[model samples]
Target: MNTDTARAAILAQIRARQGRPAAQHAMEVADVEVDIGRHVRGPQPALGDRADRIARFTAQAQALQTRVARVASAQDVPAAVAAYLHEQALPLNGVAWDTLAAHPWAEAGLTLEYRPPRDEDKLGLTGCFCAVAETGSLVLASSPATPSSTHLLPETHIAIVPASRIVPALEDAYALLRAELGELPRALSTVSGPSRTGDIEQTIVLGAHGPYRVHVVIVDAD
Candidate 1:
C-alpha cells in the first residue's frame, strides 16, 4: 500500500478507535503501524548550519600540516616519489601505477613495468581526486580514465597529493565537485584513516581487503 494512504488510514482509525466498534480479525505478521505525530523525520541539515564545524576542522588540519615528517621536495614528483617507494621497501620498478598523468619511472632511479589495469601490482600510487584536510581523507574515483584496479589490488598504495587540492571536510570536497562538474558525479569515495580490522578475537590488524598503509605525498607549490 502507498505510505501516505496507509498513514491517513492509521490516523483515522486511531481518531475513531474509542467511539467505533472494536472488531477482532486475523492479521498477518508483516503488517505493522507507526505513531507518526510523535516522530520527527526529514531530508537532512543544510550547509550553512554545518559551516562552523567545517571551518574549525580546517584550522585543526592546517596545524597538523606543520608536523608532517620525512618530507623531501623535488622539482618534479617522480624522483621524490621514487625515493619514498625505496624507503618503504618497495621495488624500484615492476609495480604498476595509474594516475592523472602516469609518467615513466626512469628519471627517479626506478625501473618498473607498467602493466595494464587487469594485471596485479605490488604497489599502486595514484594522484588523489581530492584530499579533505579536516578528516584527512583521500578521494578516488573509478572510470575509463581511472581504472578500479589501480585503487583496490595493490598491497601498498601511495596518494600523490597536490597542496592546492586539500579541502577542509568531506562536504567541502563534495561542494567543489558540484561546482566543478555542476552536479554530483558517480564513484565518489572519502577515505579517512587506513584499512584495518578487529577480527580474530578482536585483535587489531591492518591490510585486510585493501592496502595496509596509505602514504600521502603532498607536492609543494602545486
Candidate 2:
C-alpha cells in the first residue's frame, strides 16, 4: 500500500482501539492545515545578517568536521568538487541525484552515475532543499528524482548548496518547506557533517551509519 493509505489505515486502527469511528480523510486534512496555520514559533537565537549566518554556518560545519567550499556560480561547482576530490586523493567516480544531471560533471573529468547509490559507490553528489545556519545542517527532501540513498549509502557525500537557500534556523527550513512544497515528501533528512557514533567505548567513529565525509560547495548564484 502507498504511504498515505498505510497512514490512514494505522490511524483507523488507533481510532477503533479508542472506541471512536475513523474521521473523514478530508476533515483530518483540514484540521491539520488549520493547526499548522495557527502554530506558534518558540523564541530563537539571533542569526545576524545573511553574511553573518553564512559565516556562522561555515564555522559550525567546520567544527563538526565538514569541509566547506565556496563557488562563484553553479557553473563552478564541478571544478570545486573536482578539486576537493583531488586534494583528498579520492577517485573521481560517484553517483549523483538526477536533478543535478545538468551540471558539467564530464567536463570536470568526473564520472558520475545519475541514479541511486550502490554499495560500492564511494562518492555521492546531491543538492540541498535548504540549509540551516543555526545547526549547520543540510535539509534534504526526498523524491523520485532526488533519492536519499545518494547521500546515505556512499562513503563521501558532496552537496551543492545555493547561498540563497540557507536559512537562519531549523524553524525557517520547515517554514520554507511548508510554503513551497505544501506537503511533506516521502522523507526529510537533516545532515550535519559526517555521520559518527561513539557507541563503542565512547570513541567517535565516523561513517558508522552514513558517509565518512561531508563536503559542502556553496554556490553564490544558483
Candidate 3:
C-alpha cells in the first residue's frame, strides 16, 4: 500500500483499540480545530522588534556561513544572482524552479533550466516558502513546480527570499503554513545553511552531503 493509505490504516487501528471512532467525525474535527485555535504557546526567546528580525536573520545566517544579498525588488534578482555566481567563480548555467521561469535570467547572462537538478548540475535556484529568522532557516515546501532536488542535488543552491515572508521564529513559520496552506505538502525541508559534518577526526567538512554553498537573495519588496 501507499504510504498515506498505510499511515491512515495504522492510525485507524490504534483508534479502534482505544475505543474511539475509527475515523474522525464532523464533531471531532470541529473540536480539534477549536482546540488548535485556542492553544497557548509556550515560552519563547525574545526575537526583538519586528523591524530587526531581518537584520537578526542576516546575522544568524552569516554566522552559519550562508552568503546573503539584499535587493530592492524582484526585478533585481537576476543581476544579484549573476553577481554571486561571478564572485564565486562558478558557471552561469544552472537549474531553477519553474516558478522562477519568468525572471530575466537571459538578460543577466545566466542560462537556467526550469526543472529539477541532475546529478551533474552545479547550481540550482529556487524561491523559499518562507524564512525563519530565529534560526535563519529557509522553509522549502515540495511541489511539482518547486522540487526539493533543486536545493539538495546541486553544488551551489541560491534561494530567493521575499522579506515579507520572513517570520520571527520556527513556530511562527509553522503557524503561517497551517493558516495559508491548510495541509502540508509531501515534503518540507528546513535548511539552515550549507550541509556540513564533523564525522572524520571531528573536523568539520562542508558539502558532506548536499550543497557546498547556500546563497540567499532577499528582496525588500515582495
Taking all chains together, each candidate's TM-score versus the true structure is 0.62, 0.85, 0.84
lDDT of each residue in 48-107, candidate 2, tens digit only: 887888898898889889999999998999999999999999999999999888899999
* Candidate 3 lDDT by residue in tens digits, 3-52: 99999999999999999988999998999899888846778768777568
Candidate 2 residue runs with Cα over 4 Å from true position: 1-36
| Alpha carbon lDDT at 150, candidate 2 | 93
Poorest stretch of ten by lDDT in candidate 1: 63-72
lDDT of 1 by residue, 89-192 (tens): 77665444444345546767765544444445566666667777656567776555555566566766666666667665566676677677665446666555
- What C-alpha lDDT values do all the predictions have? 0.58, 0.93, 0.93
- Report the candidate with higher TM-score, 1 versus 3: 3
For every model shown, the clashing-pair count is 3, 0, 0
Off by over 4 Å in 3: 1-40, 48-50
Superposed Cα deviation of residue 6, candidate 1 (Å): 17
Pairs of colliding residues, candidate 2:
none
Q: Which pairs of residues collide in candidate 3?
A: none
Q: What C-alpha lDDT, on a 0 to 100 scale, does residue 186 get in candidate 2?
A: 92
Q: What TM-score does model 3 achieve against the real structure? A: 0.84
